[model samples]
Target: MRVRHSTNLTRNGLTDWIVQRVSAVILAAYTLFIMAFFMCSVDVTYASWTGLFSNLWVKVFTLLTVFSIVAHAWIGMWTVFTDYVKSTAVRAFLQIGLFVILFFYFFTAVLAVWAV
Candidate 1:
């Protein structure tokens, strides 16, 4: 029996597993990159910080990191809700709330990264 809903993210268990793992790797790589940036930049300043993000590659990478974060959070949270939330109405409410929040984060990141 397959549960279908417009709000459902991965839909298939295998797809969900793959997505979670890939997103985790992306998030980890992003974390390491940021850590290296901070470590190398001993004298960090507003201009230096902005300079890092101003690079085209870094800007694209930042957007990708933001996307991975949202995807990772959604899958993790949705699994938790399905496992622990017994009440149908409550689970739906929580899932829908999360769905909105994740999209909002993605859009906000896009705007922030691209905006001059």
Candidate 2:
């Protein structure tokens, strides 16, 4: 038997499953992008770093990657807490705390990425 929580962002096991898988792919792609950039560049310098991010597409993709990371983390953490933290109050508190932290992380990432 599966337990369903009303406060879930996905609210369905299948949806959550799919989301985790998709987010993993997005994260993997982002990692590959960084790896490829390093491999193709002769020297990793400040200018090269800035130049890579200067592209609008790179900025957009970075934002998407950050968002994917937050979503993936939220779902993964929520699942763990819900499964092990049997107390409703404790689970709710943990989830809310994690949500706030993830939101802040994403917000900081956006500002750092775009300086906006």
Candidate 3:
């Protein structure tokens, strides 16, 4: 005989899987857009860079990229810790550290983007 798990738990995994895929797509698209922008530009200067980010649309897209990066990193790190780190104490510690770093990155990115 076999035991069955809760549907909610199953659904949660599926949700995470879907989110990872979506975030990856977003990150890739943003990377490509930035790469193309750089390649097309004849002069790459601090003024030009700042000007590119000055656009409202670019800022919005940059914000979305930040979100995608955070989500992707969280899911990837959580999966690794859960799968490989057998020690509960060690896993919890690592997860807490990851959360702190990711949050710090998020806030810092927001500040830098909006300060411009």
- Model 2 misplacement above 4 A: 1-4
Which parts of model 3 have CA positions greater than 4 angstroms off? 1-11
Q: Relative to the true structure, how large is the alpha-carbon lDDT of every model?
A: 0.85, 0.90, 0.82
Number of the predicted model whose lDDT against the real structure is largest? 2
Steric clashes per prediction: 0, 0, 0
Give TM per candidate.
Answer: 0.89, 0.93, 0.88
lDDT minimum window of 10 residues, candidate 2? 1-10
Model 3 lDDT tens row, 1-116: 22222211123778888888999999999999999989999999999999999999999999899988988888777778777877777877898898899889999999999993
Clash list (residue pairs), candidate 3:
none
Candidate 2 TM-score to native: 0.93
Candidate 3's TM-score: 0.88
Check candidate 1 and list the clashing pairs: none
The candidate that wins on TM-score is 2
RMSD of 1: 1.8
- The sequence of per-residue lDDT tens digits that candidate 2 reaches over residues 1-116 is 35557867688889988998998999999999999999999999999999999999999999999999998998899889878988888888999999999999999999999993
